[model samples]
Target: MNYDHWGRFLAQKVNEHTGLDILKWKNEKKHTWEALSWPDFYDKVNKTALALLDLGVKSGDNVAIWAENMPQWLVADMAVFSIRAVTVPLYANSPEVQAEYILHETESRIVFVGENEQYTKINAIREKLPSLKQVIVFAEPESPEEPDMSFETFVSAGSFANKAEELEKRRRDASMEDLATIIYTSGTTGVPKGVMLTHANFAETLRTHEILLDMNPGDTSIAFLPMSHIFERGWIYMCLNRGMTIYFNHDPREIQTTLAEVRPTFMCTVPRFWEKVYGAVNENINNGPAIKKKIFNWALKVGDSYYMNHKRVKKEPGVMLKLQHAVANAIVYSKVKKKAGLENAKFFPCAGAAIAPEVATFFHRMGIHLMIGYGLSETTATVTVNRYYDFNLASIGKAMPDLEVKVGENNEIMVKGKTVMKGYYKKPIETAEVFDGEWFKTGDAGYFGEDGNLVMTERIKELYKTATGKYVAPNYIEAKLAMDKYIEQIAVFGDRKKYIIALIAPSVQAIKEYAQKMNIAYDNLEELLSHSGIISFFEDRLQKIQREFARFEQIKKFKLLPYPFTVETGELTSTLKLRRKIIFEKYKELIEGMYVD
Candidate 1:
């Protein structure tokens, strides 16, 4: 792989698949899907590249993409890469201050915004940034403000300039040493730091995945996760490389609708998505008639035996068991799969946080390929992923071929590979701190199981140490409790304390239904949560979920809130990881009250 991984190979791929549909996007106004053939997509990329050239965006200059998941987002990214410029991706929903910080820090001369909201945000903060000069909005804004223009207008401007030769020269000049992208961390701990990844890093990642995963040119993928996130961004790169047809899912709230329509062969998503599906499926079965529950449970057992015992073990199922599996698939699994539009699902890469083993197992039992893996932005997305066969449900699969992964001091997962990021952009001290010799220290605590599978323990900085010197992994506890239908969002706290405590946000609808069924009356949710019977019910549920946990690790007290932790409330990161510090400070009183007893 050379520095021309994107400029050469990607361009070649587009040319090779010129007649094929490369991108699909839903038109919000028309309520129909629009597609772009490889040639059409390539034309846009070329025009966008020439546009950047016209804007005086030279090689090595930083260009910011503050947008959501959309085809234009990739077009702009590819354009930037083709010209060997560094791309700084800000979360589509990033606050003005954060976006301003990234633009200012990178000294970005131009930025591509997704829509009006992003344009407005950047436009409002333009005065604060000395270097930011142009704003390119992906959508046609009602009014094109000064220093900003519609994406179409920007693209059209390149057509008259005749800078096509310059764009080509820059593309040919692309090198592996060129800085590719500067992805800002979600900053669950604090201020976001830009993780600098080079073209070489992406090239190696693409190669490694091609070897480890089963993917083909005609495969279909739905881009549901925000492309600003490395998991999706990197995965999409591989999809393009493999000539996979990608459907851009614009609004995440409508992912289920898009999922059913696309019925994609592959996708990348977070654990929260699966958690919701698992909860919904379980709720329906639990609330249904006894006979239905019994039938569903029986089908699940049959699936487990056939898939886990026979198929997974490479042993043929006996005739009787095969007959049972066929009945289960027809009567239960097939219906569930079709309802969720997972009937065509080949494999889905799940990561970003720990998914409950039970949830992963549920998908596996239903003949769904849910490949659980682990990695970080600094590692270019995936370091380990479960294979199509011979995978351990409890572990985060095997390391990618040729990627060095090992447990380091403090049980931190360490990596030394081509996929590891070059360093944080313009932050030498921070970059130096995350590396020891050649290994990039992944600030996660984990160890390998006896079967050579990586078993993640907890995030090193997030591990809670009790006053009694007991260590508690809150993620393990929270992941388990979150599976309960009532517990929508939970954060465990007990650092230097007697025992663990949790702040829970109950599922409002589920709680309301429970109240109706139990004959508990309440004027409002807050009042309902304060009821003695509700507290006891939650306590009973918590005890049952934590029965396997050590006594010290069990949550001693909990406070249920009527509200959920939201990204807008500063309690969760853009990626939905809990910001423990802010959450603790926000509810200091409630946490203190829990400690009073």
Candidate 2:
């Protein structure tokens, strides 16, 4: 816990601290888990560092990790930092082109991946990457050579007595000013930009985050969120700093199942994950028997009344309300929470994007704290977070200690703090453009509430003025509509147009269920979705959800997409956020058709 001028925090913690527990992960067969004790983890890091030295990697070099959240990812990250080499993380879902651009841009010397798919992707382009000396895969490689090598072999290649002494010397030589990592932003618009974060940037954020949230000694967490993201990466580091047990979830699709097993104290996530959980819970309720449905609804009503009285109403729940809640929890919410993998969760930080107000209230009613915080990758994962004691779900909460926030021109949120990135990697022109004096332009627009809590708002760049010069924030509309059980993803389109319209991607599972009930026949998802009855159903659902929004914000028309936006299709970023620019352009015809008649 030393906050001296500059030092290797991870190494210091491992060496100085005793009784550190193991990091757990499922073995290759997925039947059971393997664990790494602190001493074992420290040894892996040392070996990895020495391996890098064998690869001719030097201080200040960029090394990339293209994998999911695993013990090796953490080991490689700490190893790279131990030698003062920069760590660049690539999204596991990133295509070859995107991965190639970052690897080439950073001039990465060594790259590590988790599995075969990533290895194949990198191997396909290895010829183009002249500077990439070693491509290390977590598992055993088919053949160990200059281009492709197994991680175990890479570690073994570094087994030398001299390397350990050299590592110690390099640790002492490490400076806070040295570049620690290049975290790529989730490019929702154009190409992804690498944000340069220093050891000081991480140290400052870690120091502040430790104060904002309290994690107990034996608290555990499952990291299903993509580790390539700054949000997950920072959360992982924060857990490490707290001596919390970490569970590595190889597949995000299995989060619910894994959650049931891990029963973690907390998990960090995006609003979309909560949306799915809410939808699934509701779907089960809807499909339940009459008696069960009655109990579920009644339980929710009682829970909401009790929760609101305690949370927003600032009133103690009467004895009757408390009793009702206790019965409700025993029969419904508690069972649902336990099955959903959030039973032990104290609070999970929900950020990366805006959450629907209805969904936020839903979790709160269920006695789950979806702490709707806010931060960009450039801010080392968080600038503002909703604290446990004082928070409004509607707001992104107050800024962290030592952070300065102000509203500048156009109501754009400006921030200045130690957690802010040094600059965009090797892009001074772009870096200078984002700064206004000392404050880093957040590119988001919002106003402080009367209580001084920062209200989360739409990005300034995304605010579109219609043909009548009446500006509308598409994200606000999109968020509201996305809360519907039938809706999977939504994009509002009224920019320079007469009336607002939307491109909707209805939930495939929900649609399938509806089709079966209505006796609608179709061969494929597209055909099923395009049925007249299905269209009518969505029209009704859309109108109902739109009632929550202002008249102008309501969607007059919409086009239902047969398929959801995906990262592989270039319609979404690695973080699962819509690529608005790509989506708008790709669906240009469908959008124009909505306005035609």
lDDT winner among the candidates?
Answer: 1
- Model 2 ranges off by over 4 Å: 4-7, 15-17, 28-30, 143-147, 287-294, 311-321
lDDT of 1 by residue, 1-597 (tens): 332458667778886677778899998889899999998888898888888888888889999999888899999998888888988988888878778888999999998999988988887899999998888899887677786788889989647357878877887787888899999998888788999999889989887887645577788999999899999999998888778899999999999999889989999988888999999999899989999999999999998999988787788999999899999999999999999988988788999889888899998898997889999999998998888778888899899989999999999999999999989888999999999999999999899998899999899998889999999899989998888888899999999999899999999988899999999999988999999999999999999989999999999899999899987677887788898999999999999888896
**Residue pairs that clash (backbone atoms under 3 angstroms), model 2:** none
Using Cα atoms with residue i matched to residue i, what is each candidate's TM-score against the true structure? 0.97, 0.95
Q: Candidate 1, which ten residues in sequence have the lowest lDDT sum?
A: 1-10
Best by TM-score: 1
Model 1 RMSD, rounded to 1 decimal: 1.6
TM-score, model 2 to reference: 0.95
Q: What is the lDDT of residue 234 in candidate 2?
A: 84
Encode model 2's per-residue lDDT on 1-597: one tens digit a residue.
Answer: 554222367765666444766489987677887777778888888888888876778889999999877888988988888888988999888988889889989998789988887888888888889988778999776655655778887788645766777778888888888998898887787677899988888888878876655686568888888888888888887787777878999988888778888899888888878887787788788888989889888887887788755755567888888888888999888898888877898888888788877788888888898777889888887888777655677889899988999988989999998988888987898899999878899999998999889996788888888887888899888877776788988988888888898888888887898899999999998888788999899889888877867777778888888888988898888888778878989999889898897
Q: lDDT at 253 for candidate 1?
A: 91
